[model samples]
Target: MRIVFLLCSFLSLFFASELITPLPLHINYDKSKAILGKKLFFDPVLSKDNTISCAHCHNLQEGGDDGLEVSVGIDGKLGSINAPTVLNSVYNIAQFWDGRAKNLQAQAIEPIHNPVEMGIEDTKALLKKLKNNGYEKLFFEVYTDGLSLKNLVDAIAEFEKALITPNSRFDRYLKGESILSQEELSGYELFKSIGCISCHNGILLGGNFYQKVGIYEPYYADENLGRFSVTKLEEDKYYFKVPTLRNISKTAPYLHHGKVTSLKDTIQIMAYHQLGRELETLERDLIYKFLLTLDGDIPEILNEK
Candidate 1:
C-alpha cells in the first residue's frame, strides 16, 4: 500500500514537472591536470606487479566498464562486486555500490590500495617509481608540491569529473530538440507510472540516493550487506547506492553482483523484487527500448589530445 501510494505520487509529479534532467555537454576542469590524470589512469605502474591499471577494469572506450560480471584485478584477482561504469559518476552523491567513498577524490586511490585490485602496498616505493617514470615532471607542471598521493588522486578525480556523457536521444527530447518514438514515449510513461521513478528520478535517473535492492521481496542471499558494510547498521543491510541509468544498455550484467547478464532478465528481477510487480512482455520490451535511449554521447575529453 505504501509503495502504491508513493508510485501514484511520483507519477503525478512526473506529469507536473521533469523527473530527470539532461547531462550538461561540458563540465569545467583543469585540462592539464586531467590530461596528466588520464596518463596515470592508463598507467600500469600504479599496480603492485605493474600489470593492472584503472583502465584494466574500466575500459573508457567500451561503456567505461570492463564488460565483465566481476572485475579482474591485479594478478587476475577477482573483485567481490561488479565494476560500475565511471561515465557520469561525478554526479553520484557517493561512490561505490556500498556508498563507502564520500566522493570521487576519496574513491580514486582505493583500488591502488586494495589487495585484490592494484595492490600497491608500499606507498613510498610507488612514489619512487612515479618520480622515475616521468610522472614527477607531470606533477611538477600541474602542482607546485610535485609528486604526492594527494595530488595524484586529485588529478585522477579531475579527469573523472570530465567523464560526463551528454546528448542522449532522451536528453535531446527533454530539451525539445528531438522527439522520441511513440513506443519509446510510452515506455518512458511506464517507467514513471510503474514506480521506477520513485528511486530512479534525477539527472542521472539514479545515483542521488540509496535504496534497498529488495524493497518488496528478497532479491538474493549474499555475503555482501551493501550499505551495512559501511554503516554497520542492520537497517542498511541490502541497501545500495542507486546506479545511474546512463549507458545502461552498454553496462551489461547489472546489479552489484552482476549475476544477471541480460537486460530483460535484470528488468524482470527489478520488477519482481523492487516493485513487487510482474511486467507484461510488451511492457518489458517497451521499457527496454526507452532505456536504450538513455545512452549518451561519449565524453569529449576522451578525444582530446
Candidate 2:
C-alpha cells in the first residue's frame, strides 16, 4: 500500500500540465571558483573608478537588484534599462532583457566595459591591474590560463550559476512538504485560468522564452527597443526575455525600464497589456498573494555583507 501511494504521487507529477515546475532544492557549482568569483563580484577593482562592483547594481540583499528604478553605476552614471535580479538568473534562457549575450560569461564581460555601467575603458589594462593587485595566485590556482579574461569571466559565471534560490512556499508545496493557504490556492487557480501560465511556466516561471510585453495592447516606455537591439529584426521588436518570478516580491520597480513599482499595479498592467484579462480587485489581490509565495530566502552571500 505504501509503495502504491508513493508511485501514484510520482506519476501525478509526470502527468500534470507543464505550466509550472518546482525549482531544485539547491544548485551545484565549484566551491573554489564560486568563492573566487564572489570576491571579484564584491570587488570594485573591476570598475574604472574602483567604486562600483556587480553587487552595486545587483545587490543580493535586495532581490539581486539595487532596488532602483534604473541602476546607477560607475562614475554615478545611470543606465537605461532596469537591472534584473541575479537570483535564479541561471534559469534564464538568455542573459539580459535584450537576450543579446548568449550566456552568463558573455553577459559578465559587457558590464565591465559598458560606458553606463562599470565604465572600464581597456580590458588588457584591467587584467594587468588585477594581477598587479595581488590576484595572480588566486586566478592561477583556479584556472589554467591564470588571469586571462576568459578565466575571470568563467569564475564569475560559476558564482552566478550558483545564485539560484529555492525552497519557497510554492516550492515546498510542489515538493509535498507543505500546503498552500486557501487564498494562495485560489490565486494559483486564477493564475492558470487567466493565461499567465502561457508564458510564465516551467522551473523559473517566466525566463525560458521571449514574449512581447504588450500583446493585447501597446507597451509604451522610453527608448526601450528590447530584443530588436540584438537581432535587428522587425518582428523581434519589443520582444524581451521574460524574467524569472522566483523572487518577484523583493524585486520591485518592475519591467525593462523599472516603470512599475507597486506589485499590485504591475499585476493589473500585465493583465491588461499582455493577457487582455481585466482582473477584478479581489482577483488581483489573490494573484498578488500567490506571487508572494514565490519569494525565497536571500542568498547567503548577501547576508555576510
Candidate 3:
C-alpha cells in the first residue's frame, strides 16, 4: 500500500509539472477579494434556511458542480435549470443560462432570495444573522459599509473572480510552453475547423457570448424558455448563454439542459446538428483527448475549508 501510494504521488507530481498550464489571456481579476470571497462562498448563513451555501450547487470537490441533473435549492426544491460549474465563471460574458445577471455582483444576489434557492427574503436580515460570526471581522475589514448587501455580493463576486481555471493542457499548448500529442492536436484542428471555436473562443472559451441551441439541430423541447425569459423577444426563444469550456472535463452533463452526458456525444451532436459536419472515429477520439485536457486541480483553501 505504501509503495502504491508513493507511486501515485510521484505520477501526480510528474503530470502536474508537464500538464499544468496557466490560464488564457483575458480573464483579469483581483486576488485580494478572492480570499474573502472563498470564505463567504462556503458559509451557509448566506441562505435563508441556513442550510445551503454557494457550494451546495457549485462544489469544488465535484469540479465546481454538485453532480446533479438539476440542482436542489432551498428546502430541497429541484431547480428548473442544471447548475453550471463555477470554475472559470469569471470568464463568462454574462451570468446564468438566460443571461439574466450582468456581472458577478448582480449574479450573487439572485440565489439569496430565490424561493427555490437560498429563500432569503431580505439581504439585510441575512447579513445581520451572519454579523456576529466570523464574517463580522472580515466584513469590516473588506468593505467600508460592512455587511451590506452590496458588500456581500461584492465579496462573493470577488471570490468567484478568482475561481479562474488556468493550467489546463490546452492552455499549456496554447502558450507554446508545451505540446499536445498528435491526436490531441488533430482534435483541436477539428474543433476550430468545425466552427466550435466561433462562440467558444476567448479565455473562458464559450462564456463570452450567447447562441441558439437548435441552430444546427432542434433543441429537445421543454417548457423552460431560455433567453426569452430575459429578453421577451420571440426570436430569442431557445437561446442560452454559451458556456465556457474551461474545465470542461469536470463540468459534465453538457448544454443548458444537461441532456447529453458524454463529451463524445456532445461533440458528435455538435458536428451532426450544429456544425453540419461528421467527425470520424479518430477525429472524435482526438477531440475527446483535447477536452479531457480541460480538467484542473482545485484551490487548496476550498479543500481545507
For each candidate in turn, give its C-alpha RMSD to the true structure in angstroms. 1.7, 6.7, 10.6
lDDT of 3 by residue, 1-305 (tens): 33553354345433433322357433555555667888778888888878999998998777888777778998889887789988877667889998899998999989888889889997667877887676777877877676678887887887787676566777777677557887787777666655666656666667776777766557664677788999999978887887877777777787777767887888888777665568888888888888887765565445433
Model 2 compared with the native: what TM-score?
0.92
Query: Candidates' TM-scores?
Result: 0.96, 0.92, 0.86
How accurate locally is residue 175 in candidate 1, as Cα lDDT from 0 to 100?
Answer: 91
Clashing pairs in 2: none
Best by lDDT: 1
* Model 3 TM: 0.86
**Displacement of the residue 23 alpha carbon in candidate 1, Å:** 0.3
Q: Residue 6 in candidate 1 has what lDDT?
A: 64
Residues 1-305 of candidate 2 have per-residue lDDT tens digits of: 32553354345444446567887766788878988888899999999989999999988877899889989987678988899998888878999998888899999999999998999989999998898888999998988878888988998888888887877999888878657999998898877766677667789988888888787788878778889998899988888998887889999989999988999999999889877778999999999999999988666544432
lDDT on C-alpha atoms for all candidate structures = 0.88, 0.84, 0.74
lDDT of candidate 2? 0.84
Please identify model 1 stretches exceeding 4 Å from their true place.
1-16
| Pairwise TM-score winner, candidates 1 and 3 | 1
For model 2, where is the 10-residue window of minimal lDDT?
1-10
